[model samples]
Structures are given as C-alpha cells and as structure tokens.
Target: MSARQPHELLLAARPVEILGVALSPVEYSGVRVMTLTMIDQVHKRPDGTARRNFNEHRARLVMGEDFFELNQPNEIRALGFSRPQGGTPAAVLLLTEAGYSMLVKSFTDDLAWDVQRLLVKSYFAKPAPATDPLASLPPEQRALIALMVDNASIKAEQAAQSQALAAQAEVQAEQGAAITAVGQRVGDLADTMLMLARPAGAESIVHIRERINKLHGLPSRIIDEVLRQSPIAPKPAGMVKHSREEARGGSYAVYWIKDVSAVFARFSGECTRITATQVTHPYIDGRFKLLPARDRP
Candidate 1:
C-alpha cells in the first residue's frame, strides 16, 4: 500500500462550521430566545435604509427531534434552543400525540358517556381489523372502547325485545283459557235446555243467550266469542231430536253430550241404559255394537 497522505486522518472527522449569522432580542410565544452565537452584517438599501441581518437567526428559529410537549412547560423548555445532534432534526415545534387527541376527537351526547368511561381505563385495548398483528401486539398505545359500548347497547335492545315477547305470550295464554271456560259454560246451557224445555216452553235463542251470559257472569268479550265460536251455542234457528221427543224452536248447533243411554234409546227404539256418562262418544268398545234392537238381529 502507498504511504498515507497528510490529510488522510481529517477525512474521518466531522466538518467544522466556519460560517453562520447573528440576531438577538428574538421572542417565541412570549419567551425570549437566546442563540449560541451571533454575528452582525449590514446592508444599505438604495433608499439609504440599512437592514442588518443575523447569519443564523432564521436558520433555526426552533429545531430538534425531541418533541416539545405543549401541555408540559418543562418539556417545552427542555428543547432549549440548541442545534440538532446526531440525525435529530432542527427548527420544529412538536405537536404531541395527546395534543391531537384533545384537538381532533369529538363526541356527541349519545357517545359522550362511553368516551368518559374509556378515558378512565388505563390499559385495555383492541385494534382495527385491518391492522397487522405485529403492530397490534404489545400495544403500548391503543384502545377499542367504542366497539365494546356498541355491543352493550345491542344486548340491551335484545333484552327489551325478549321481555316484550314474554309479556305478549302471557296475554295470549289468558285469552285462550278464557275462551275455553266460556265454551264450557255455553255447553252446560245447551244440555239444560235440551232436557227441560220443549219448543212450546222455549224462549227466543237471542234472549236465552243473553240470559246465560248474565247468569254465568261472562264478560262481553267472552259472551261474544262463545256465541261466535262455541259449538254448543244455540243458533238463530233449528231443533235437536232426542229419545221420545223431537224438540223444536232453537238452533240444534249444541255441542255433543255423552248420554249413551239417550243416544242408544233414540236409535234403538228403547228407553234403557240412560245412565251412561253424557259426553260425545260413539262407543268405548264394541259393546256399543249391541245397541239398536234391529241391528242385533
């Protein structure tokens, strides 16, 4: 190798600044600025106005990589009007992350409470779906309080709907029971009319229906429903025949009554076995095959 040149070692050292400007009495946000060095230069305009310039005043009104936190006086002062070191920048006023949060984020009344809750929490956070796992993991700074609030609101709505449905079901069950009871009362009225009154003694069907409703203390709704829907409700016209008597003068739309004895006697031409439970039934077993005098032979 050739011998090293006399200036070979100088190439490795940082270059020294031999040039700069100077100015003073400078103020920033009410604070007096002091520079490391100041030099004076004067220029006389053609109009005879002299403008003196500072070689480095505007070059670095403010500069540094370190952020000047506006909220904290100490951090702001920490910037200290010094030149940048290493790769750090110069002449910049830093806007802190917290500063942007207060300035940019806004909430209306509906979401205000959720934001309040979120502010109190120190360390729970979720990330955006599109964010990378590497960026999200070990989260030193992030939160998903808004999403949680949305979920809680949805659950509250669902619970309210479920309660409403349950109440509707209860009302429907009560209505069904009332209809069944009204039907039973109307059935009893039919059997009584069948056994005790012949056409000559019977009243008008409409009149009899009102009497039965009043006698049973049935509500108007129940009364109307019974007349409309009950199988045993006396119709506006007709008659039902029975053993030994063909009664007329009321709708025969009466519900079935099990009086095997009555039914047997009517069909068989006999007046025996009148003690059978009065319900609607063809027969319990083939024993009913013995019914009717003519069929037996």
Candidate 2:
C-alpha cells in the first residue's frame, strides 16, 4: 500500500484543530457522520450530553434516517473511533447532519454557533467523489459498509420465511374446518338411512314404542305420552288382531307400523308447542295438569 501524502495527513487531522477538540471521522451509507462521543467532544459539551438529548427526543427521531446504532464490537470498531475507557461499548450511535442539528437545537451560545458552522462546512460537508469512493475511504470504513449490506440481506431472508410459515398455517386451518363439516354431513346421512329401513308389519303399541326409541333416541316421556293418548280403536286399514297375555281376556288391537308415522307427527307437534310455551307436561306423575294462565298454548 502507498503511504498517505503530507497534504492528505493534514486533511485527516484538520477536524481536531477546526472544532477545538479531537473528533473522529465516522461515515455510514456513503455519508460522513459524528458519533455521540465525537459530537460531545467537538461541541465542548459534557460527556453523554448528546446521548441524553437523543433519549429525550427519541420518540420523534426516525431510525436509519436520523441515526444508526452498531451493537456489535466488530461493527463499532469498523468506524475506527476510540473505544470507551472501561471496555468496548454495547452500542455506538452515529448521528447524521440533520440529527446533529436537532440534538443541539437548545444550545444558542456563541461557542455552539461557531462550532456548528465549522463542523458542518469542514467535516460533514466533505464527501468522496462517486467515481472512486472506496479509494478515498480508509479500510475500516469500507469493511463497515460491506457488513451493513450483509446484515440487511439476512433480515430480508428471515422475513420471507416467516411469511411462508404463516401462509402454510392458514391453509392447514382451512383444511381442518372442511374435514369437520364433511364428517358431520356423513353422520346425518347415516342417521336418516337407519330411520327409513324399518320392518314391514303391524306392530303392538309396546313394539312400536321400542322401534321409535331405536330410531330417534327420544326422551322417554315423549314416547310414553304418544302411546297413552293415541286412539285405542286403531284405523280399520291399519289395525291387526292380536292376543296378548297382559290384555283383558287375552285380546288387543295392534297398529300397522307404516300408519304409526302420522300419530308420531301429530303428537310431536303438540310436544313442540308445549316446549315453546314453557308449560309442564300434560301427564306428569300419571296425572293430567291444566295449562297455566301464563302459557300462551
């Protein structure tokens, strides 16, 4: 590597004499900037003065536009600035020209005015020409530029992976819902098929009640009421002569299974009306109860 000329060395050290304090050269995103330490030193303010001011107006400041922070020691050191006395700092803040203006807005002293004018002109205003930018910047500043580009690429890749995972989860949720709906529909079809496949013959009242129970799984009270109140003298076309031990003189009339559906329909309508009115069942405890005045049915 060729040695820097005498005039180049003078240019490098000029900011210290111009600002009345030792200010490091820091640049980022192809723009010259000042660190918090550099700003405090150049402005003759107390250590951490710039940091305090930054914290106070942090909400209004836009990151990447007003300032940048380097958390890693390697990245911070890449700026070639002096490390804090104790050890490497956890973060180093880089302030742009606009950021510096905002940070020292409250300082109106003559010294503040003079320092700001000189630094803006002699230090921050100087930029390397576009034709050969890296040729002018030191090796450390070039390394920092490469590091920032790599970090931005990594962040973009991570964002794409997160979006893909979210889309996959949404598709899985939709598939699960569709499967559940199909299962419910299949169960309903099975129940309907079982109800329609009854045997073709006249059935005794007891047998009819059992068949209804198997088909509907209805509450016991509903079936009991329908069997007790249906006409005892069955329809001529639907009745069958039967002899049963439990009947008086061993004789009883049974109903055709096909005709029993009408009785079920009529009695079910009455049960629904009673349920809607919130009235007590007619045959509770084997005794009929009059409808209450509050019941509309």
Candidate 3:
C-alpha cells in the first residue's frame, strides 16, 4: 500500500494510547499530548463456573520522534517514563508481551485513523460569519442606522428614569400622608390614656371606651401605634365585633377585629401599653350576642 497522507496518519494515531496525555501546555514544540489508562483481564472457569480477573496497566506514549531519538531523556518525558539520552529513536513504545496483546486486541488501525480524521475536522472547521446580513450596509447608511439606534436607546432610558422618579415621588407622598395620619392618631390615643389614668372617683370608663371606639375609624398604622402604647392585652383568637354609638350622634358603626389580642401582643411589653377599646362577646347557648364593654353606657 502507498504511504498514508499526513492527515490520514494523524487520524490513525488518534486512538493510539498516549502514555501521558499532556492535559496542559508542555515545554516541547510540535508534540501533541494525551494521557490514558490500560486494563488487563483474564477469563476462567472455576469449578465449572465462569469467572474473570482484572489488572491495571499504565504507560506514556511519546509520538513524532525517530526510533533513535525516542531514547533521549530531554526529548519526551512525562510522568515516570522518559527517553534515555542518545538511544534508539522510535515513534512507538516497545510494549511487553501482555501489553502488546492487550493493545492489539483492544484497538484497530482503521478505528484510530477514523477518529483522528474526525478530530481534525472538528478542530479546523471554517470560520463563522462575524456580522448579520442586515449589519453589512454602506458606511453612510450604517452611521445613520447607528445614530437612530442610539437616539431610541436614549429615549427609552429617559422614559424609564422618569417613570422611576415618579414612582419614588408617589411612594414618598404616601409615606408622608401615613406619617401625618399616624401622628394624629397617636395624639388621640394619648388623650385616651390620660383619661383612663384619671382618679378612680373621676374615672369614666364610658368616655375611655368611646375614645377607643373612635380609633377604629383611624388608619391601620395609627391604630397599631395606639395599641402599641396602651396597657390592654392583645385581642384574643377568633373573630371580634364591637358596636359603638357614634360620637357625632349617628348610627352605631360595627367593627370587626380578627385575632385582636394576637395582633396587639406582637407589639406589646413596651413602656407604653396598648389596650383594645372594644370587647368581643362569646356565643351563648349556640347563639352569638353583642355585649357592650362594662364601661360603656
């Protein structure tokens, strides 16, 4: 047969077991590196039963050197194997009887050549197109296109910035309103506390209850803050309802506090104790009833 081409030779050697596959860059030039492991096995029948045993073989292969050059230590050395200085240079390693048999049985020249060709094809393919078809316009046209894109980008960025600012402003306004509302409610709660702390003879539970009832109409934050500063325990679990006569002489407003004590206790145990201005009535004889606070008229 005629001598194989360079590519064909590379392909044939592709599957050859290299002793030390240089996983990293090496000091030598024009030398491709690879590391591989070898396994040996024996099959036998033990007492009429089939069995197999395995052994491991390891070696490094240094290619591309003449038979006499391979023995040189400086030429190819990776792992434990190295070429002796100024010895018979050979491209192929001299394997022992077992090693030779194993390699011969495990790999074929055709498979090695085929794999090498595939590796060459994969690594040395044609370059890809750098730009899309639409991007390859005349110089003036491209400049105009780029300018348009820049302007659109600027406009989108400006709109987004404006929207973020507006949202931030709106949030700030809501926060300011909530703060003011909470301050007013806190003032009202202070008044109620003062009334409750009055002398026993002058104490008016009705008035205190009325003041607390007004808190129901306040914003949730104010209500929470008032409760935070009051001495009353948190509302108990389950549903709670309070019916109160309006301070302005209107119909009674019915309010519900779900898990009132639990919610109150979340912010309890501070210098300022929060008490509920209302009470819940239990179901009596399978019927629900509304009972006013003892302080209520």
Any runs in candidate 3 off by more than 4 Å, and if so which? Answer: 1-114, 126-129, 132-136, 196-198, 201-297
For candidate 2, write residues 153-250 as lDDT tens digits: 99999999999999999999999999999999997765443322223676666776667655544345556555665453235233332335454333
lDDT of 1 by residue, 1-297 (tens): 155431111121322221222222322332222222211121111221111122222242223211121333343345443334543223433312232123223323444434324422311122336855446545433245556778899999999999999999999999999999999999887766554333443444355445543443323443344345544343433244444444344334332223212332343332234324121222221122122333232
Decreasing TM-score order of the candidates:
2, 3, 1
Give the number of the best model, judged by TM-score. 2
**Model 2, which residues run further than 4 Å from truth?**
1-16, 78-83, 127-297
Scored by lDDT, the top model is: 2
lDDT (Cα, tens digit) per residue for candidate 3, span 73-143: 43333213433464333332322223323333433456444434432343222246687655768889988
TM-score for every candidate vs. truth? 0.23, 0.37, 0.33
lDDT of 3: 0.36
Each model's C-alpha lDDT?
A: 0.36, 0.63, 0.36
Worst 10 residues of 1 by lDDT: 42-51
